[model samples]
Target: MSATRPGSVTFVAVLVYINGVLNIIGGVVILFTRDQMVRASNAGAIAGITTAAILSIVLGIVILIVARGLLSGSRLARGLVTVVMILNAVSGVILLFNFQFFSGILEILWAVVVMYLLFTQRANAFFASRA
Candidate 1:
């Protein structure tokens, strides 16, 4: 059941790690700028903003965990990454509809690339062997 680690898997893992780091930074920024954000928004929106920031932080941590698992060729990691990539792709589509063309397109492209890499024959074999 031995299998070589695929380049695609490596690329996907690297990208996931980088994205996770960015997500962590964004979440931290949101937390730090909470005061100004809360002041600018209405009373009800304040709670939503806080919740979003917290969720972002949690999401970032989860992403990092998944990425680490992926490097170890975990089957669960592949499933988790697939789910995340799908959600990201959907979000990218929504972004496009909201007129954020560039970002939306970039997001979609990145998600697609990750998805492709994960499903490659070599990647699949590597994960299966590790299982």
Candidate 2:
């Protein structure tokens, strides 16, 4: 438990922060343009878009909080992030079936890289020391 903080942790933290910010922004944008999306998709009601926007914003806040915990080397944060990444990867795969090929691939790759970084020897040691 004597190793210094690994670069992987810092890298993941930064990526998480960026992801959080993007999620929030995307949610807001989608919320504001709900009318357009509903019309374009011929979805009639705006209920679905509204729900998605809200969920995105909530997810963003949670991610931001987890990123903060991660920087501090919290074990719970690592677990939480791992779960989130797995969920994201699953969602990405689902999205691929819906024609979101580029984003889906990116999400899966991001999850894999984050998982690899988090479980590395140096990262594990860093978290152990913080405990």
Per-candidate clashes, comma-separated: 0, 0
lDDT per residue (tens digit) for residues 19-83 in model 2? 89999999999999998766765664688888999999999998899899889999999998999
What would the per-residue lDDT of candidate 1 be over residues 23-116, giving only the tens digit for each residue?
Answer: 8889889878877875664867777777888889899999999989998999999999898789989999999999999989988998898889
What local lDDT does model 1 show for residue 27?
88
Candidate 1, superposed: residue stretches over 4 Å from native: 40-43, 90-108
Per-candidate Cα lDDT values, in order, are 0.88, 0.90
Structure candidate 2, residue pairs in collision: none
Q: Candidate 1, overall lDDT?
A: 0.88
Cα lDDT for residue 112, candidate 1: 91
Q: Where is model 1 poorest over a 10-residue stretch in terms of lDDT?
A: 38-47
Q: Least lDDT summed over 10 consecutive residues: which range in candidate 2?
A: 36-45
TM-score of model number 2:
0.76
